[model samples]
Target chain A: MDTTQLLKGVLDLAVLAVVADEDGYGYDVVRRLRAAGIEEVGDASVYGTLRRLYSSGALTSYVVPSDEGPHRKYYGINAQGRAMLGAQRKDWDEFAGTMARLLGTEGGA
Target chain B: MSIVDDAIAQDVRTYAAQVRAALADLGPEHVDDLTDGLEANLADALADDRRAHRGTLADEFGAPADYAAELRAAAGLAPGSGGQRTGGAVDRALRQLVGSVRDIEGTTLARLRATRWFPGVEDLLVALRPAWWVLRGWALAHLLLQMVGAEQGAFWLPSSSGGWVLLLLAVVASAQWGRGEWRTGPRWGRVLRFASGVLALAAAILLLTLPQAHRDDVARAQGWGDRPVEDGVVVAGERAFNLFVYDADGRPVEGAQVFDQAGRPVTTEPYGGDRWRQQEYWPDGAGDPLFHVGVPGPNGETRWNVFPLHSVPGWAWADSGAPLDVTDEDVRGEVLAPSWPFAAAAAVVPWRTGPEATLPAPAGASTPGATPSAEAVPPSDAPPATDGSAVPEPEPAVP
Candidate 1:
């Protein structure tokens, strides 16, 4: 798959994981994603995904008004989102271990 | 100077606007930076394309839908199904509808804004800012004079027309103020200045023509009835009475009545006319009376009048059985014969030129069946004249 497509599939997991640690506004999420080496992530896409996830009951949002500009909506993962993250992590570990074994690497196994 | 460059710039602007609209659902915090970056990139791309003498902007930038898709992807949302999106047709139709509605609304707004007084007095202030201090002083003085009721005082004085003169002065001042181009210095401006001057003059004239009223005044005046009376005679058959009357201004009067010889009014109320009431009446009523009469004018002119009923099918004029002592003079003066279809169909028997002509018809002579010779010809072979100019030749000068 293209890096963009691969990146898209993991974005939800990344967002939940980031907000899993601390709730963040759209810009904060974008900054964290960029810092984490996801250079292809766009500010708009992160916000849209955050809203979608929140609407799908994985995340909840709260408004924090700023004197500098408009109010900011912050997102944090809910119980269902945390459970989804745990399942994704487990699936990733299993896949990585299987790939290591197929590659005949002790570290992978 | 380059068409390509201009087109590219326009495309950039248009694309930017579209992007703005599409991303409006996204909160400003989320999309503002991305949208700004996109606009900058789009502009640069268009500029670069123009420099390279590339193909059309549409070809260069790709299809708008594809661009929107790319933007949506970059924004990190799930990509829409590349497969046939349900409601795609409906969505396209709705977008077109919204676009057309927006275009119409925009045009209407532009037209309305182009009218005077839009952008308003602030624009006037900006344009006149150079002479602001002097104009302000003058305005203050003018208002002070007005506050003391100078206009009313001038009206009561011997020089009663001073108010008009003052108005003319104000108009001249306004024209002069509009004449000064201000920022560009006092040079002859374009035709717009002249137009403004003309408008000011028109406003002055309108003000002068307005009736001045006093709040203290309580009395008022009114006019009484001055309607005219017209008379006519219809000899049965179908007839159409077209009443013509004008007001003092020679305007057509509306809503006049036609009365039968028995003093019975036979016309639809609410007739229309400029000066006198005009109406088309049919003699469909019973007991064919003598002459049909219309109300007389204030000038005592015969108010009600009728003409010989035309013989045309479906054509009926207001009528009365009253025997009119109509000589060639009466027919020549007011009541002309009905034209065409009516003339060809009605049996018009001219009364004999003698004492019998002046005498009332014998009893029962007004009976309908007694006048069979006067029956309007049904399907007469009268060819409708072509030029409408061929006069009927005199009947061989009867010996």
Candidate 2:
């Protein structure tokens, strides 16, 4: 089963979760997502999510010029973003738990 | 940078520009942020020591408009083809036109840079930007002045006409003092400003070349003589072509330039001056009749508007040759026609001086720039009716 559709639904959750732990710029967020094993994550999608969250008052953003590369706009999760991240994490946990049980892999079958 | 690296950098910039063009209708702030991000990523992608020199960033990221669409989506904006497709009917049409034009211009520019047909077009356009920018600035200034009902300009500049003097002054100022910003060395701001200063010079030249009067000034400066024909008449073969001014019948009766049936300027050249058989500009071309004459169009601008000259008449108009034995009827029937394929394809039927006319003998039918020893057909007498037939001479001196 393709995880792309699933990732799209929880992109907001995933972006907030990543930024909640530590602030990151657009490309940095993409790199972090890839490192976290979400290979399907697109760089542009992370950027869009950051912007959307910032516009909705769920994230704080700032610009920092880099000597090594182009200037970056860093996005940090705020109170509202943290709250939404927690709620979505709980929802995803419950859903995943139900799905796992439905699969009946109790003894590593 | 290596040539390949430089080339890739240019391609990247072009891609970024395409993205910018697609997002043009969006507020500048939004567009800027997105483009900035895109550029930063591009720099990282190109500069990071890992990726090999391989496919273009465009191939990886897709086309510019597609990338822009993705960027817009990432920014939580509507899809490019949806609510954000642009405004009303007129707006949509304009956007489509702009999009197509931008795509065409950008792709063609990139592809043509290395081609013989438009070599150096890319660099030339880039260098021409300063002139373009300065002119645009002055034009804006004029528009604003008109809006405020200012009839006179502040300096010697005109409210409407003489903004080029203003542009030249600004370019001179920039070249002189624009380096002040760069005195501190090549920071982003200093380097950018330094680059802009280079355009000021280009702008000055662009301004200088903008008008017909200025073009004439350039010609005079180059000592090509502003106008060659006197009183609109050129005495090529004892008969004159009144090219510039009108005759008594209020028509251009004579000119060194001859037109084909389709009104194409026939080619000609003078043998005495410059390089014999070398093409020269119109107005200046009468002296060297080997080249077709160039003229300013109905608009004051000079386009490549040389009427294609038939090679035979062209040669005759040369200093060493005689006038074509043609009448007013021949001019209407052959030279004034709307197309020239027939005129070009038809056999060299010698102009009829009477009911019985003979084609000029090959020995006497030599082009003006041809050997002077070759006898030329006289203007008044028809060639002797040898064999009572038209002689088919080998066509030469014409492509």
Candidate 3:
């Protein structure tokens, strides 16, 4: 599969995973996504998705002003987001195991 | 400024307005920080986009309203689409009305600033002290002109003009004064002074043009007259035509047209009646409803209507009869019958009669038509001319 499509499939999972550890603002989330090897995620798209997820009760947000630049609006995963992330991780692992079994290869797992 | 910077600023303002609108239910206090934060982020993103040579920040991020809607949705606010009728309609109407009024006022003020007399007045007032002195002097000169029949024996006082001149002078003086004593007054004083200067300029134009507007009324009352010719042919060369008509006061009259030697209606369509007043000229093919008139020019053959008076010596009235081949000299012999109203309406039109009997003396004996200087005496006591008859008496010495 193309890397873009692969990245799109995993974006929500990646975002939930990042905020699961620590809250982050729009650009900060973009930086974390890049550091985690998902370079295709746009800044605005991340911010927009973060907002959408928060509105859906998957995440919560609070604003903190920065001395170096404009204030940061940080988002953290709530109980709902964590539960969704855990379910998605389990589904991905099971799917990988099934593909490995069908391919009959050690690397496919 | 760079186009990107301008676009960014515009986007920021638009985003701010949308966010504020969406957050109306949340109250200003709750939304102010959020909107500010969003704007700051948007600005930074746009700057980054510019640095990266991206086409438009808008394309990268969706429209500001969309972004605001997303934010509002996240905040658990009602979607924007559902609240179209409640307060939004009223706000939109009010904004539209205000925007239209502002557009008209701004256009009018801009046209006023572009005129020559405004700058001349500014330069005159700047060299003078007690700025009121310059204003009072113009007022007095106008009063004296009104008292005399000099301006066609008609009172020509535009109070708005004097008010504007005084205003401009004060603003200029205040700026100068503030520069010397900046520590005393607040910074807002300078802004007020700048605004005052702009208003003064607008007022000056209103004053000058308003008076001339009266003259236009008088000219219109003298309705244009036409001379019936059995047959007239306009040649390829220049020709002059004259006619006597009564001015219909200031009311606009239908303009006349000219015909070719063959009587193939050469004049362009008549304009300047109730339907439309002013028409713009465009050199390119962009002109709307192109108007064409027959006139011989340097380029073999071309059509032009409303040639400047200086270029074309006389005016042409539309002729309905057959075209007769006539030279400029031949056309000179034709006598124009004056409209009966032109001869009889003298009683009603002030210019038709002699200067009004109550003419006033020149303020402080300055020669009439000399263009009053800044030092001229402030003729405060002279009462403003009320009626058309109270023309100020022209100084006998005015050359």
Candidate 4:
């Protein structure tokens, strides 16, 4: 199954989690997501997700002038983003638990 | 060396532009936001450990529109096809127009460069840009003049009050561009800049195709174009023929007004009423339905044979009972009569004589005993007197 569909639902969560720990620019977020083993994440998708989240007030951003290239737009999760992330995490954990029981993973050797 | 570098620079620029176009209609701010650092990022990627990447850069990005769609979806924005941005139909259409113009200019320029073996054409075209700028201003002024109701179809620069106004305005516009910048305030400044570009393009087209081929009243008056015989074919440079006018009675009608088939005076010469021109005789009295009188060349003694202009009903009309009606109040004929006399009469409907006919015996031979009978009228419009007699005495014009 193409996890791209699955990843679409969790992208908000994934992007917020990556930036929650430290502010990162668009491509930097992509690099991190790939580093975390989400190989299916497209570079453009990550950039757009960052923009959407920032415009929604879930992420705050500032431009850092660059000597090497274009000034980078760095994004960090704000209080609103953190609050939403906490809520989403709760719902995901509950859903995972129920799925795990149905799939026989609860006590399977 | 620089040409190759320019080609590369142009390639990169074209790619970036394609990307920008894909994002058009999505909203300018949104498009810019997505593409802000894309070029710089691309430069970096290309620089990283060269030789690591294979194939063309386009292969990596795929089609720009598809890429844009992906970005739009990821950003939670609606697709352009969904009509979210269709409210800017004008804006979208303008973008497309500009795009096409740019594409045409680019391809044409590229083709020109590629064919540089044509010897100076490529470099010459590039060097002509400055000249095009000047022409642009001139063309722009002409367009503005016409828009404000200056005469249309006068391809030459304006000589009227409006033309002077255009010159003055151009000087003012140039004056405003000091130190390589426009001095006008922002609003008017932008208007001038845009007009300058549009006018320049328009001027480019005008200069390329309009001016040289365009004929003006001045040129026509100067006998620069199709002229009528009534205009007396103003012998401007090297005159070919001299026209002498006469009445239906073959009496030398000096100063008889010449007219075109439409009855327009070929010249403003005092002979005719109002003239199509002031002084110069229109060449060959350019008009349909003309007439010509032919006298056999030096080969034989022949009187003038008049033929109606073939343009009338056709050449056959000249052979009709009255190939032309010369005796009317006004007969407009433009013709190249054969044996075109350097000095001859302009009588209507010159008479035709068979090729075997010889000139009438010289009229000076007439004696009282001959009684110049009923056959005295010459069969042709040419007065029988080859010696330039004032008139032909009889119907046959000869005994």
Score every model by TM-score: 0.26, 0.35, 0.29, 0.35
Q: Can you rank all candidates by lDDT, best first?
A: 4, 2, 3, 1
RMSD of each: 28.5, 28.3, 31.7, 22.9
lDDT tens per residue, model 2, B1-399 = 689867877777888888888887664445654665776666555665533435777676677887777677766676432222325778557545654564454344434533675534544654564565555455444444445665442222454444555545554544444323323311343354545555455446545655765556566667765444422213555422212222334322222233444444332333212234334332222442333322323333221223322222344343554333333234212222111222222234544566324333345433222224222211112112133223422222222
Give the per-residue lDDT of model 3 (tens digit) for B8-70.
778776766765676665444335424535666666666553235355555655565566555
Error of 2 at B251 (Å): 99
TM-score per candidate for chain A alone: 0.85, 0.89, 0.83, 0.92
Cα lDDT tens digits for candidate 1, B1-399: 479756766777787677655554443322342353454445544443223335664565555555555556644543332222334677668645644564464345334444676536534644564454333333433443456666432222113355445544654565455444232211133244444445545445433543353222212221123334333323364333433333344332232233454445344223322123433333345232112223323333332322112121111222442222222233324332222221122234545568556545556554322333222221122233233433432211111
Q: Which candidate ranks first by DockQ, i.e. highest?
A: 2
DockQ of the candidate models in sequence: 0.04, 0.17, 0.05, 0.14
The better candidate by DockQ, 2 or 4, is: 2
Q: Is candidate 1 or candidate 3 better by TM-score?
A: 3
lDDT of 4 by residue, B1-399 (tens): 379645645655666678778778665656766676666555444544522455455765556666667777887777553222543778767756754564465344334434636326544554564565556556767777778877656556686886877866764554445223543433354466687778767767776767555755457657845565433354566432335455655455422334454434343223321122112222243333322322221233321211211111124233433434432222324222222222245446656676225433345343222233332222234322355434523211111
In Å, candidate 3's interface RMSD is 17.4
- TM-score, B chain, candidate 3? 0.18
**Candidate that beats the other on lDDT, 1 or 4, i.e. the better one:** 4
Clashes of each: 57, 23, 24, 27
**Which candidate has the highest lDDT of all?**
4
Candidate that beats the other on lDDT, 1 or 2, i.e. the better one: 2
